[model samples]
Target: MAIVKLSTTERRRLSVFFTCLGLAIVAWIFTTLSSPLPFIINEALVYKNSPQKKAFHPLQADTIKITIQGTGWQMLFSKMKPDSKPITVDLTPLESRNYVVLSSQLKLINAKRDANQQITAIDPDTLYFDFTNRLTKKVPVRALLGIDYQKQFAISGNVSIKPAYVTVSGPADRLQKIDEWKTDSIKASNVNESIATRINLQPVTEGNLTIYPKSVQVNIPVDEFTEKTLDIPVKLINNHNYDNVKVFPQKVKVTFTTSLSRYKDMSDDLFEATADLDLWRDHGYSTLPVQLTRFPPFCKIVKVSPANIDFIIKK
Candidate 1:
């Protein structure tokens, strides 16, 4: 190949360009070397293949806190890398105020990268955790059924619970709320026969509370066994112009099945029987009609045998 020779000016210009390039390369290298490496904070360094003796208990918290030291820029940008397995400390093996440090607890980006970079413990060497001891206690269970039924309707049935007592366990403070445990409200509206149902336990007021048996069976007795009658005096409607009107049935019988305690409070004035005088007026009759005036608040109307009776008017 034939070579072309450059003039003096061209060679000098080329030399100057090469010198500047070399200086720039050296400066870049110096800046890079002066920069600090990154550090990670609260990063976990997990170690696998740890001995069984070092395994943490199932009830213990799984996370650990750690602090690492490195260059400001490196620490700001670099992320902490942890092993696949968890870094655990065995609570069973630990003595009071004593902790075990694993060689693999902390890892650096490159051990040789910077000799100044280090791992340190921000808190005490050992962590203290208050673990609760599991305990079981039997507590009485109560059932709260329909106690707010309408006045006419009454609640009946066993309303009893199976395994009246339940076994509950948890932290001491949690177990204290067990005595207040109860079932949700149940309805016994217009019930005529016995009843049985499965009810869920009410929400617990405290955390960490656990009940051994989830559900309770409730038995209610809607006793159709005893029935009683209340004789209510019949009242006559407006008797303004009727000088010769009389009602065939002067009294009525109000029947209900209720316990003796509630029956005694029953009264004869609990029923109101009245004859409609508007119907007589509409039919061009000069006499007034009888009607049911008043009834007991606790009594319900079942049937009026003779709904209407004739009012005789003499001219």
Candidate 2:
């Protein structure tokens, strides 16, 4: 193979191109390092497992605050693992201080390891958080059912809770009046059938108190009524044995009212009236003797003005 060398002019041109490229790379590096990106605190980070030995309550500011550093676009799209993690702080440590003290320490979140040990990097390694010890107090649990109905109806059953109480933990101002909690009124008219509804736990005074059971299950009994009319049949006593004997006013006038609840099981043939045939047989002998028949169930024979009537015997 034969080798050829470039001319002096060609070498100089290549040198100039390389110098410009090197300068551009330096400028890019400087710009990237000098500029700071915007970020947001998405959650709190807890460094030690024993930040607070006691259980932590919800909505209570504790051992950590999660600070995320990134461009607006990246922060908006980024998310934290285990979306919700309990951050604890030791209240005993801050007991000496008159006011609550916040710790300046922070922890970085790392990628979780699987059965196969491997190093994984989680984005936004370091996180900043604010910590304050919260006071816990007992509060009454109020049952709430979020339902609205028309008027003329009411709800029944378990208006008061069985274990009608709960515990709350938060700022001192909010925990002062943590004895009771009331829920919004549940409309009765809206109730058609039994229902289970959710209600928010609101503080009587605007404070940072966190309820143990944030929500409660309310059991409401709905009342329903229907209107109906029943037609009861007017019956005649001794109807079969009447043979030649006639009844003046065949139907015994009966007009009464009953409730719709029991009306369905009732029939019209439940009422009847009859004449005393013993009077006729006493006067003279004839066919078999007859008396008033039995009445139907749940029925009354209304106003038999002339209950007894004379029956003429046919020779």
Candidate 3:
């Protein structure tokens, strides 16, 4: 095939035509993307201004479809990076009515949003709720703990939580089942010292339920424990016969574990040991078992020497 060479004038004309075509295409694309458009996206719902006297449960899902008006670039970016914040819905109207209209609150809701992206409409414009008898009760607060204490060190006393009870209000059916509300876990490792801090209560997942005072103050006492031995006098009880009844040993050695702070205060007077005489009368038992009737709190009993005592009944 014979090659055809273009003249200098022809080559210049062809280059100018292609350049103008490229610029026109670029301008057209830019103008199209800059125009405002509407797009629909889903947003979670958060309720506020709830009525104190009424208990309400949503009849529909907790999500709403929101239509926003913005430029094509904003719409594309919104699709790529979605908004995670839930839309706050005012439930003040529910005091007199059982339903709320989302369109009525559009002006108030748009105040917090960016001016570039305005919400135009919402699907399911009317949100309805089912009403039931509201019930409020004071329930105990239980703390969940995970602690790793150092050797010879542990919790010395009972874990105390301020305002041990919290007020919970919800539908009667749900409130009746909740006897106690637990706080989030309190975890610690190498817990050699006492813990005094505030912890958050478990969050309410059901929108119908509400708990006052979301957090509580906790105080955990910690100390080192040591072994303590005491010689407690044994008492004879149920001496019905008009005769002398005596136990072979008047005192028995008792070993226990107690906190170091209270070690010096420990004494045999705080404990009581008894050997029941009825054991010999009721059953033909040869020996009476020594029983510890009382002891101080927070003390772990290790061993009670001479568990069984020999008794003599002289009639």
175-213 per-residue lDDT for model 3 (tens digits):
989999999999999988999989999998777899988
Per-prediction CA RMSD (Å): 17.7, 20.2, 8.4
By lDDT, highest first, what's the ranking?
A: 3, 1, 2
Which has the higher lDDT value, candidate number 2 or candidate number 3?
A: 3
Better of 2 and 3 by TM-score: 3
Which residue runs of candidate 2 sit more than 4 Å off their true CA positions? 1-72, 75-105, 108-138, 150-153, 156-158, 169-173, 182-190, 196-217, 225-315
Q: What TM-score does each of the candidates earn?
A: 0.31, 0.33, 0.67
Alpha-carbon runs more than 4 Å astray in model 1? 1-129, 147-153, 224-315
Tens digits of lDDT, candidate 2, 1-315: 998788999899999999999999988866664454444343443323322323323233333444334443343344442334433333343323322233222222222322221213222433223334667777676655556754533343345453467666666655675567766655454555666666555543312334566556566554443333333222333334555665444444444333334456545455444455544446543333222354433333343433443444443
Error of 3 at 60 (Å): 5.9
Better of 1 and 2 by TM-score: 2
lDDT of candidate 3 vs native? 0.91
lDDT of 1 by residue, 1-315 (tens): 999798999999999999999999998876764576444345333223322222222222334544455555454345444322223433332433233443333343224234555545433344433345556679877888674444433544345888787777666655665565688877666565556898887764322345657678888654333356666555655557665656555555556555444566666655566665545656765433334566543344555544545555455
TM-score of decoy 2: 0.33
Instruction: Judging by lDDT, tell me the better candidate of 1 and 3.
Output: 3
Best by lDDT: 3
lDDT of 2 at 161: 54
- The clash numbers for all candidates, in the given order, read 21, 10, 0
